[model samples]
Target: MHIFVKGAAIAFFSLAITACSSNPDDGFTGKESADVLYSDARTAMETGNFAKAARTLEQLDSRFPFGAYKDQVQLDLIYAYYKQDSTADALANIDKFLKLNPTHPDIDYVIYMRGLVNMQADSYFLHDLLNIDRTDRDPQNAQEAFKDFNRLLKSYPNSKYAPDAQKRMQFLKDRLASYSVKVAEYYIKIDAWSAAAVRGQTIVETFSDTPYVERALEIMVQAYGELGQNTLKQHALEVMKTNFPNNALVSQR
Candidate 1:
């Protein structure tokens, strides 16, 4: 009876091993070729199944690191991660691709996408839903995005992405200018006249093209006035009048 039980157990264990080996859930047993995997990934992406697409692409990458589809796979994976809201993963892959393929034909598009990703990295869904202003928050991500877009434009002036990147740079400029203005306002509120004046000066010089320059000049005027720097205050007032003659602050001065 004992011998029969052992034989039955051996038979069941062998069958279980065979079943596990052939399990469909075991992803990528090296059976599918790179082309087949690429096709599967493309179909998933086209169908808006980015999760599946990412998984399949990752498998393909591991299976065929130097395959003909390597570049396209990396690009698609970046987009998939972006769609999945996996910002860190997307950025990591972007950096990796850039490091390895600096002179690749599609480098311009990759840089443009990097800027887009950074632009939305710090977005607050609740703030958008409630129509709340986020200018007072830290603008680090916006700054990075601005630099990325700027690099793209400077490095590839005739790139197809330049026009869109220029537009995004404009938006980021306005946002960064607003953030500086907010900081100047905070310094003014706390009676930090020198700091406020410096911040306002930075805004005037760095963001002279933005609408916030007017507010920055006003802040500088007030801060210098509080510091008893009459000459500096007059200079700020003069610039404000020259640029924004109809501004109420200019009128008051």
Candidate 2:
């Protein structure tokens, strides 16, 4: 009886050890350490394997949320998402970083990247491939990008990104002005003279420094004339003569 009991106890212990050793969850639970995972993620990024880098970084984030490299990992993840054209994810991460680390030394860079992501968010791949003019499409993304760049400049004027942000803002301003002009032209085509005049006036008031202002003035004159607002028409013509001296519209008037 004592020998049989001893054999049964040994068999039970062996079975327990086997079950523990063969558990899939145990293998999965033994994740790589934070340092090793971060190193691997960096290597993936350096190799331009952004997809792999993103996955690894996401895993590292989930496993070690408060690790020593937390801030840097978030920044790297943002870059990885941007490189992969995951605009929504990149923006979400950027917003989270900005909200959480408002005083981070690299906040200006984050803001600049936010602007860049928004700038490309609405870009049509096929349009670029075919050299198409899609400026007439909705400028919502461009407007958001413009606001972001403007915010960055206002908040961090001396940042390294300021110069590039300024250049992009100029581009956005011209694009916005052009979009307004297109809207004015469409209103005129539909014989909505009052609406066209309103759009033209908005362009003149808001985008006065843009090249589109000359066209906007022309639109104002045409729309006001069609609406029989002689005073407004003459006002637009006089402004055109003063600013655009040799404008074809002025000579026609």
lDDT of 1 at 208: 85
Whole-structure CA lDDT of model 2: 0.89
In the range 4-45, model 1's lDDT, one tens digit per residue, is 766676676687567434524426677999999999999989
In candidate 1 the C-alpha lDDT for residue 52 amounts to 80
| TM-score of each prediction | 0.87, 0.86
Backbone atom clashes (below 3 Å) for every candidate = 0, 0
Each model's RMSD to truth, in Å? 13.6, 17.2
Number of clashes in model 2? Answer: 0
Off by over 4 Å in 1: 1-30
Q: Return the lDDT, model 2, position 228.
A: 95
Q: For candidate 2, write residues 1-253 as lDDT tens digits.
A: 7567666766766875674345232122436999888898999899997877887888889999999989999999999988877899999999999999999999999999999889888676546644579999999989999999999999999999999999999889889999999999999999999999999999999888789999999999999999999999999999999999899988875
